[model samples]
Target: MNKSKVLLLKNCSTGLVSQVMTLIFQFLTRSLFIRYIGIELLGVYSTFTSVLSTLSLAELGFQTAIVFSLYKPLAQRDEQQINDIVNVFRFVYDCIGAFFILASLALLPFLKYILTGITVTNAIYLYFLIQAFSSACTYFLAYKRSLLYADQKDYISKIIDMIVNVIANILQIIAMVYFKDYLLYLVLKLMQVIVSNIWVHWVCARLYPFLKRGKINFTLLRSLFSNVKNIFAGKIAAYVYSSTDSLVISAFISTVQVGYLVNYTTISQQLKTLIAGLLNPITPMIGNVLATDSEGESKEGAFKLYAVMRVLIAMMIVVPFCVLINDFIAMWVGAEYILPASVVVLLVMDLYIHFVHSVNVDFINAAGLFREDRDNEIIAAVLNITLSILGAKTIGLAGVLLGTVVSQMWFWFGRSYVVFKLCLQADKEDYLKYWLKNIVDGVALTVSIVFCAYLNSRLPIANSYLKFVCSGILCEAVSVALFGVFHFGDPEVRKMLKYLVNHIGKR
Candidate 1:
């Protein structure tokens, strides 16, 4: 096997293992948290996580641009150029870290306003401080890990992160159970972040001993910052679009409601993280392919296969999610903690939309079209926030998630258009067919969800866990069957199935 395929397998296998372990620990921690601590505190944890995530947007997508810049030099084995780029990366992160400190401090007074309905205690501020410090530490200390990412050595970091997460989750569980102190739990979380980053930094340094302080390449730095400026707009838009939902809920509704929502989101996020982890290996390879493939034939073929895979994966996930999410929540916690059916369906739909387009979004970044999609991202951001706030006040939680689904509709077609026109340079008919196919896939997904929901309603299982398991199995089977019925004749699907079967047979 070639180097790229080997790297992809290594990354995917390690990432899958990491995500599975992390998911288990996350549920265990969250379960202990709700049982020992309070759901309100869980809400606070979820709220502050979003707030800190939003604050971290000060990094302004520079890491992405810098990583993109590294592809060519690394591909050519130009160590000097790589070192210079790393120097630029180091300098930029230092500045970002300093700025993060100042920004976090400035936002301290406003925390009272953001954490509405919850008492703004000094311990809360201290917890935020520790979390902020941990985040800033990444910028100042762990920026070298990006080089590993650009080098397609992400499996190294994945393994380190998995180890750290398991250990941290174990420690946090002990703290929550024995100490029963939220502050101690937060401290353990901080330690986890620091330790993981430090490990990645060490691995990067050992692997790339040639990395050292060097003269900054001003011209390359300038070009990178130019990409950063365009990418920054999209970064802010993305941050506002996704991270602010919690903030809006906390401000308009209650932190306790945010806590209720967090349970569902935890499941969604864990799955999304797993999906991203499995798919992330493909990104650097895509970048490498784009850097070298001038004719776009290889890019188009890979994308078509990935597009089908994306739909298949989304169908498998979203359908089961719609059918079984509430049952799982009830089984995991209690039915009282569950959100309404409307909210659950909307949440699953939102996840479906995001999962379906995740590949295209990654492709857009690989194509370096941040500047092109700047306006579209900004518009979506504005639409999401506006609609979410309004929907929250008017129709409540379901409406808030509904805003997310509506806003992302623009992204679904908009991203595909840009990828086809600029990236692939495909003809109009191909783009139209892709759009039509996506529409059919969306319909199939929605119909499958309904069918699965009806099937789940008819299941005779009395036990909660058993019901969840049975519903999940039936939902998945039905979703896959529906997908095959819709796309069995698709040339891309046939080619992909043949490819997978041949590869598995070889194995």
Candidate 2:
């Protein structure tokens, strides 16, 4: 195998392992929290985390901007340029840390208003303070990890994060079992964040010793600032897009409803995280390709193959999710906790849209086309918030989720246009053809999934767990068969299969 392939495999293996471990620990922790601390506290905890996530915009998208800036330098082995970029981020992060602290404090006074479905008086403030400070302190050293990512050493950071999270989750479980104190739980989480950031920083410092040397390059800094400004706008939109669901549910609906949604979201988010971790190893590679071969035919070919893989994965995941989620949720929590069928369907549909479009988003980021797509994201965010609020007021949870589906469809179109026109330099006809093909694929997958769901419902399994297992198996089988029939002649699919066969034969 080639060096790039070896690195890609290594990164994917480590990332998948770490993400699986982390996901297991997170589910365990969440389940324990619900069992011991009660659902109200879970709701409160979810709300506070959402609020703090909003505060994360203080980082101002610097990590992404810096990482993009490093791709070229790293590819060229320009240590001096790498150091200059890292130092600029280090300085900016320190300022961001201070700013987060101040902003968090200013927001503290209004926390009471956001505190719905919880009766904790003064302790909540302390919890927020610790969480806020932990978040702030992360900026001081977390910038180093971006170096690892841009250099295709993501496995190192992933491993460190996994270890830290495993230890923290174990400790938090013990605290909940023995003391039943949410305060101790939050502190444990805080320590995990600090340790993970510091560990990554130390690793980067050791791996690239020159990271400590060299001053900021004013020319590069000016360019980075431009990217940051554009990326920050997208960052705001992203935060609004993902983070506001819980907050909106808390305010417009209730925190308790947010808690229930969290149960469903937990499964979906973990799946997304796992998929992202497996796929993210390829991002820096994509960035490297864009840096080295901006106009090369190889880049476009790679993108087409990637797009096919994403569509296939999305189909596979959404099918099982649609068929088995309600049963899984029933088994994981209780039947009462399972969301309304309409809400569940909308959630899965939204997830499918995200999975399908992720290829374009990743390419857009790799190509550093944030400036071109900034307004697109802002518009999507606005639409999401507006639709979500109006929907929540009118139709409740389903409406809120429907807003996400609509916004993601908008994002899908906009991002595809940006990637084809700007990044790939493809013409309008080519872009429209590619866009229409993906839409057809999405629609076809939806039809297949609906059939799979109907088949699952017709199964005669009586036991709930057995039914879930049977439903999952049926969904997987149906999805594979349908996609095989649907894309039997797809060149990308054939090429991927041939590569896989060759790889296994070599093994």
Best-matching candidate per TM-score = 1
lDDT by residue (1-507, candidate 2, tens digit) is 998788778788988898788778777777778878878878888888889899898777779888878899999999888888888888888888988889888987887778765665788788888888888878876888888888888879988988888888889999998889999998998899989998888888788987665566678778877767887888888898889888888878888888889988988988898899778867877888888885667778778889888888988898898878877767776678777889988988888888988999999878877788988899999999999999989998888888888989999899988888778887888787787777778777877888987888798988877888878888888888888777789889999899889999999
Q: How well does each candidate superpose onto the true structure, as a TM-score?
A: 0.92, 0.90
lDDT of 1 by residue, 1-507 (tens): 999889878878987998899788878888889999889888887888788888688788888888888899999999999999999889888998999888889889998888878999998889888888888888988888888888989889989998888888888989999989988998888788888988888888888899999877788878887778888888887887678889889888888899999889989988888888777767867888878889989888878888999999999888888888887887787789988888887888789888888778988878878778888888888888999999999998887888888888877777888888888889999888888888899899888988888988988988867878888889889989999999978877998889899999999
Residue 45, model 2: Cα distance from true site in angstroms: 1.4
Error of 1 at 406 (Å): 1.5
TM-score of model number 2: 0.90
lDDT on C-alpha atoms for all candidate structures: 0.86, 0.84
Looking at model 1, report the run of 10 residues with the lowest lDDT sum: 277-286
Worst 10-residue lDDT window for candidate 2 reads 209-218
After superposition, which runs of candidate 2 have C-alpha atoms over 4 Å from their true positions? Answer: 1-7, 71-84, 208-223, 281-304, 423-432
